[model samples]
Target: MANTSYTRSEELKEILSGQETQLQQKMDEAKDMASFLVELVDTLEVTMSNRSAKGDKEKPLRYCTHIMEQLDALGWDRVTLVDQDLSRVQIELCDASQRKHLITARFPPAYPTIPLTIAPLEVPECEDDQLASQRGLSVGGLSLKQGLALEAAIRQAEGQLEIFREFWDVMQDFDERTWVIDPEKPTRADKMRRCALGNHCSIQVTVQPLSPRSMPDTKLFGPTASIAPMRTKLYQNAGLWDVKKLPRENLEVLLELEGGFPSPVSTNKDDINVGCGICYSFRFEGQVPDQLCSHAKCQQPFHRVCLYETITTSAPKT
Candidate 1:
């Protein structure tokens, strides 16, 4: 019998080659990751540079002033800073349905990066049975006991006001419980589907309940959202193959429950390399209807000619 050990040299060489290639891939990925993080810091730095160079106390003042100007445009004269630090403010805001609400905002020494603290100065408390009738309490899945315990919490929040800059808009969401995708809701084999909006199940995303404008940003662009643009730029900077990778799910999930805020898609953009699943080649431009998968879940675009040829070869010629 031939020496099997010596004969397996070819297999060993193949294994070694595969490992070398994998090592190179890992090196490339590491380099890319580092580059991406630097680019992200750079973007943040640019945004920061554009901001007024103010001390912590002054920074909150400018942000509040910007906010006040916005509120004043709506004929609101009730916004007032009530705190010595200028971190807290009281505003009279009206919701979409035009119901009046008294909202308060208190920013930590760290404001935007960490959500601002907010409270509804005057939202009415409800009976246990009325928990469901209460916008936030019912949908938040709070037990009556939990809801009652949160009366203090209901009155206040460390919230998403940093992103959602309007009193009425933010306060209304505080009152209305938002639908959270069950993290355990599996859309694809223990992976709950990221929304066509590119939102993850665990992340808190605010939807303007029943609004048509909330549809996917565009078939190709995803959401025309404030957060998505920055994330897309980050993903591109990272040279990540899939730009839609979510990095902020953990923080977002907590903020959602804490503040009843919606999740913004803090992730890479909806840029996918569309390749022919048949011929296995990608294209930046291809025939729209024939090249693209119309199916929502699978949207790789194929060469229309390649697809027709594939069909012809597989089927018996008449």
Candidate 2:
């Protein structure tokens, strides 16, 4: 009986030791799980802190309010349109000469921290080079960079407007005083003017914005015979070009026309000089017939395309 009791006690001790080993393993697993959870919580806290820092840096609401304040200070008359999301705004500015110009400003979410983009709505064809050099911004006189205030940007644009005032003044004179054959509607950005000189002849001139008072690059469009005398006069009287006079007056002196250029209102519609003889239309696809019959008696104008098609159809098949 004594031996049996001792064996039972040893068995009990073995069972208890096995249970203690299992319990130790469970405790170790719980400790590992708790450590992993703590690490995960730390990572989450860092991510949230980074998100908070980024949100504070952006401050989109503050940017919108600042833009609104700036626009209000500029006056409501200058504000043409504003986007619902406050991403874009258009403003109308007048030069010293009272000529109006429209400019657009686009803002990013992080505006004022980053440079906003500004550009003129109607930039001129000749000013493309200047625009490219200025990074597509019409404010050539100002070097816009990050942190530039909206008011400063606007002031710079106004200064640029004044710089081009004389150039626009010259263009305005041409539009008002001369019968511009091309560009039915002239804009402030237009540097070239093709004016009618009667007898199916027109003079195309490119004026330099920087030197509006100087002689422009001129080209005559007409039949060979009609243009020959004008070309000769242009070469002979080239020295007579006056920087003091306007472009129209200088062209008149150079061309030496007996009568001034044909007036838009005074011109007769039935006159053969106006439209293409073949199409009987003044403009074909936004262009007038530049090709003219060489014969002085005919002097009939023909669209280059129309003339080509007629000649091709008339040719005999091989």
Encode model 1's per-residue lDDT on 70-153: one tens digit a residue.
Answer: 445534465644565556666655444455445565654433333455443332222234433443443322222222112233
Residue 278 lDDT in candidate 1 = 68
Q: Lowest summed lDDT over 10 consecutive residues: which window, candidate 2?
A: 1-10
Per-model tally of clashing residue pairs: 7, 0
Give the per-residue lDDT digits (tens) of candidate 2, residues 1-318. Answer: 111111224423322333444334444554465654464346445644664566544435556777888888888888899877677889888888888888888876545544578864454434456643554343333334434566778887777566567778888877876677677677777788887776777788888776677888888888888888999999999999898888788877888755655665656545426568788876788877878887868887788887888899999999
- Evaluated against the true structure, the overall lDDT of model 2 is 0.69
Q: What TM-score would each prediction reach against the true structure? A: 0.23, 0.71
Error at 126, model 2, angstroms: 6.5
Model 1, TM vs. native: 0.23
Q: For all the candidates, what are their Cα RMSDs to the real structure?
A: 29.6, 16.8
Best-matching candidate per TM-score: 2
Please list the C-alpha lDDT of all candidates, in the order they appear.
0.37, 0.69
